[model samples]
Target: MGKRDREILKNICIESVAAEGNALAHVNGKTLFVPLCVPGDIVNVQVTHKKKNYMEGYMLELVTPSPMRLAPFCSHFGDCGGCRWQPIPYDKQLEFKQQQVVDQLTRIGKLDLPVIAPIMASENTVRYRNKLEFTFSNSRWVPFEALRQEAGAREVPPSPAPKAGHQSAPESAPLPVSGSAPATQLPALGFHVRGRFDKVLDIETCHLQEEPSNAIRLAVRDYAIDKGLSFFDLRQQTGFLRTLMIRITLTGEVMVVVVFAHDNPEAGEDDAARKALLDYLQHTFPQITSLHYIINTKRNDSLGDQEVIHYAGKPYIVETMEDLEFRIGPKSFYQ
Candidate 1:
């Protein structure tokens, strides 16, 4: 390849859809894989790798959008990172998904197999099912757009202090302050940032779950903040509220599990902390059939080994499907 051809490609026209939900385009006879793009879209990409048969690059700029592309329905698409293929039409996405299965079976498996059935696409795309987990972080994941707006000038965090509008912690609420240092970082109750586990993006409205899902999550977060409930700090592994798990069954029964760090008062913990949050939730959303809480002192937040205590209602929620009745625990797997 010539020197010009080897340079970073600009306004490269996408040729076709490629494997692994990537777009394929030939650059100087080498196939380049560009993610978060569809065919007919022209984009400027910075080449990161050069392989023998294929190359890789990240999308730098979108020059011309593909006609097949549709507007993303989710507001957190760019930063949240779960729904990368939202811009692509659902039918096109389904086509690629089906092709992916065939490609894997024929190319990778190398086995003689009969024609597979067509991929089944869900009729309802938004909030089709139940169950979602949102994490709490002391520091919210800052989006690149914020930095871009700053234009190389970053905003300095103010000296650590209680967030504005939060005056005093309830008698039962956990310690509101992280430490003596100025309370600069605010709390975030949302999904983890893409590729960065320590950071989480504060979600405003998630379309993953049905009606009360968003309502319940927002209410809990707001109530906790207003009552000066301490948000769990992953680094120090202190604070009060940690992860939130919500499950809704086919019978419309909802189960919520609120995980706290501990109940030791010396560590700024409180036994009533769980009760305060649960009482608020129960009063606000009376539809909750089963409400529970857990105390996880370890550095990790996995609840498999932790003991789940029932705060208000039944310990296990029952779900019936045909002839089988499955009782779900606080941390049970559901399809």
Candidate 2:
């Protein structure tokens, strides 16, 4: 740790929420930003970074919980880097967002604009998104809670090098473990951790998408783990499974796109495991209207220029928007 890491500010009161969802405070004329903290919270923070005009830190202790703060609904709320304002009520969130717009236009820009309209509220908060993308990672990010639990436990062994094929050997490999030692590597299938593209948080459930989305993701992950399928390593750019995309339309249509890394014939790439996984998905999820797969060999996870092969079901799904029918292909861009 550096000098800033050892500096702990005691009893700092968070005055407001900043634009980036950090709790804001003023200490000795310099602005202090603390993450995972709500306004009116009195917290003890360990300063991570410091500058002349600003300082940023993570909360070490919540000395006083804000009355306006509500319990976050998601277990991975603070760590996952999504839905940061979940502690604030929906009405308060709307108000804050409106104030943000007013401040940005009139106060910050010095514009002589008329009163801005109130922001529209969505009917549903959870499970309202039409699409979600999940990344497959060989190194699963170990949560702090798990680390704490395994503080004095035995050191976990590092994951073996993944083969170039679909399924690796040693099918009976022990399940991944978490520990304080540095050798704790695990396969994960979920969203990437905030600021760290190389590590992925192993998500058990995500509330952003509807039922079938979570079910399908979990099923795929479980099967992959059981079959010793290699997850794509973001840093090394190896392994088989790359990404999973699920799209659900209001017109009762579902589309699933499974992206696999390039097959290496030199290292004996097994196509049978890939076929088995696709067959399992097709047989299990009959509701999936369109199923497609792409072989993305590029270093980055972009499929814009890649060809999308239809594995099963229809090649495209239909979405109806007020009598405007749109055919959504694997590469189509829709909100």
Q: Best candidate, TM-score-wise?
A: 2
- How well is each residue in 1-335 modelled by candidate 2, as lDDT tens digits? 47423466778999887787777899989999887788888877767788989998777677788999898898777667578889888888888888887889888899898867788998998988888889998878876556644656854444444334322223221122322225656688888765567778888889998879999999999999889998998889999899999998888789999899976666555577778888999999999999988889999998889999899888999988897999999888987
Cα deviation of 88, candidate 1, in Å: 1.8
* lDDT over C-alpha atoms for residue 158 of model 2: 45
Instruction: Pull out the clashing pairs in model 1.
Output: 160-182, 160-183, 161-182, 161-183
CA lDDT scores, all candidates in order: 0.75, 0.80
Best by lDDT: 2
In the range 1-335, model 1's lDDT, one tens digit per residue, is: 43234435777999777765678899888899977778888877766678898888767567788999787798777567577778888887888888777778888998677877877888888786668889877677655444334444545343234334323222322121112112346578998765567767888899888868889888988888888888888777778889998888777788999988778767544776777789989999998989998888889877889888888777878888899989987878877
Give candidate 1 misplaced runs (Cα > 4 Å).
1-7, 15-24, 29-31, 48-55, 147-184, 265-268, 320-325
RMSD of 2: 9.1
The superposed Cα distance between candidate 1 and the true structure at residue 174, in angstroms, equals 39
lDDT of 1 at 224: 83
**TM-score result, candidate 2:** 0.87
